[model samples]
Target: MITVITFNPSIDTLYKLETFEIGKVQRAGDVKKSAGGKGINVARVLNQLGHSPMCMGFVGGYNGLYIKDEIKKIGLRDEFIKIDGETRVCLNIIDKNKVSTEILESGPIVEENDMIKFERHLENILEETKILVASGSLPKGLPIDYYGLLGEICRIKNIKFILDTSGKYLESAINSHIYMIKPNIDELEALCKCNINNKEDAIKEAYKLLRYNIENICISMGKDGMILVNKDSIYEIKIPNIKIENTVGSGDSSIAGFAYGLLNDYSLKDCLRLSNACGMSNAMNIKTGFIDVNEIEKLFKEIEVLEYSKI
Candidate 1:
């Protein structure tokens, strides 16, 4: 089983409107609310794909309970750390055109001692873990290097670690013994300290990440597909694009697909295929982090993985 960690989970409210006008009251036609966090999003997708994922994170107050219930409602096996502060709530407003606007909240405040307790909780579950995924932002009072510490523990336990975060959190964990990471192209550019204007630069810069001891790096470009970087081989994966209902959680879906691939010991080429297929299928539906098995099967057949050339 894969383990997912969400430092700051929330209640995500998606409001659908015909059109949103500035300074005017808008009525939503349909509204949906559920658990929202980078890691939690991946967990939901994993459950949908018939995988058992154990989710761990911080939640408190009534909203926290609501988040827990929503996780169970979606059939995600979960174990959350209860805190004193109320969990956050985030808003996503989608217009008829499928354009989305978001309002996000910073989640519960966690004391330093509480972080220790979380690590202890993690200890009890590590034996069941095949891969450990820690995603999203750092909660209040928790150190940025917390993810790095997680990497350290995973290394000692011989479990693969996959990190998907940004800024200081990414910086701190970049040098850890991570099995893989799914940083979008922009994040990739920043990490490599150079702009990736073409395929050559994309491959070259991605290889630079291996210097930090990262075993694999997947840089996803929305329409251009994704680039895979490794020590022995490099490949570029491109897929047919479909009309996008919503782009939210597509990245998380890709992460879950890749993790699922690694857990099953699929070849790198096959893993990239699964990742691209899952990501593309997510855009085919209105629900975030969701995919139609039929959509995934069709897209999986259309994926093309090519060797790169500097020429």
Candidate 2:
């Protein structure tokens, strides 16, 4: 079983408008809401792919209740820790031209006792968990090396830990025996402190991460697909472009796809193929972290995973 841990979860509210002006009253053409956070998105996509992932995180108040109900509605096991503080609400306003303006909340502060409860809960789940995924940012009041602690625990359990986060959190977990990390081009550039102008550059920068003890580094390049690097081989994955509706959660969907492939014992090339297809499929949908299996199947065949060393 795969387990997903989202430290800070939220109710994502999306608004679609013809135009958004600063300091003006604007009417929205459409509105949507869903249970959100990086890890929750991954769990949603995993559930969509027929994987019953155990969703663990902190949630509280009415919005938290909504998240719990939504998780259950989607047939995922809900293991969220109840807290006193309310869950946050993140707003994404998309204009007619497909430009997104975001307003994100810092989320509720988690106390030390909350982390204690979470660790206890996580310990109980590791026996049944094969892959442990910890995504998103740490809520306020938690230490920066929180993910590193989780990685160490997963390391002792022999479970594959796939981390999807950025900045200091990503850096903290680099040497903790992580099985994989999925960072986009911008994040990769920030981490490696170099500009990646092309696929070759992405491959080279990704190689720098191998020394951190990360077994697999998947660098997403948006429309250019992604580059996957391991100790022995490098693969350049290419995906056919389609009409994009919303790009949020595409990375989480990719992580879910790769985790699914790993759980099913797929080859590395096939794993990258599914991962890229899932990300591409997410872009074609309005809902975040969602994909139609038919769409994924179609995109899967179109995805090209080339062994870079042989090119």
Best by lDDT: 2
Q: What are the per-residue Cα lDDT tens digits for candidate 2 across 1-311?
A: 99999989999999999999999999999999999999999999999999999999899899999999999999999999999999999998989888888889989989889989988988999989999998999999789998998889988999999999999889877889999999888888888888988778888888888898899998888898888898888888888879998898899999999999999999989989888888889888888889889999999999999885622
Task: Write model 1 residue lDDT over 1-311, tens digit each, in one string.
Answer: 89999999888888999998989998989998888888998998888778979999899999999989989887888789888999999998999998899999987789877788888999999989989999899989898788888888898999999999977789889877898888887787777778888877877887778898898888888989998888877788988868888888899998888888888888878888888888888877777778888887788889999865433
The candidate maximizing TM-score is 2
What residue runs in model 1 are displaced by over 4 Å at the alpha carbon?
308-311
Q: What is the Å distance of residue 50 in model 2 from its true position?
A: 0.5
TM-score of predicted model 1?
Answer: 0.96
TM-score of each: 0.96, 0.97
Name the TM-score of candidate 2. 0.97
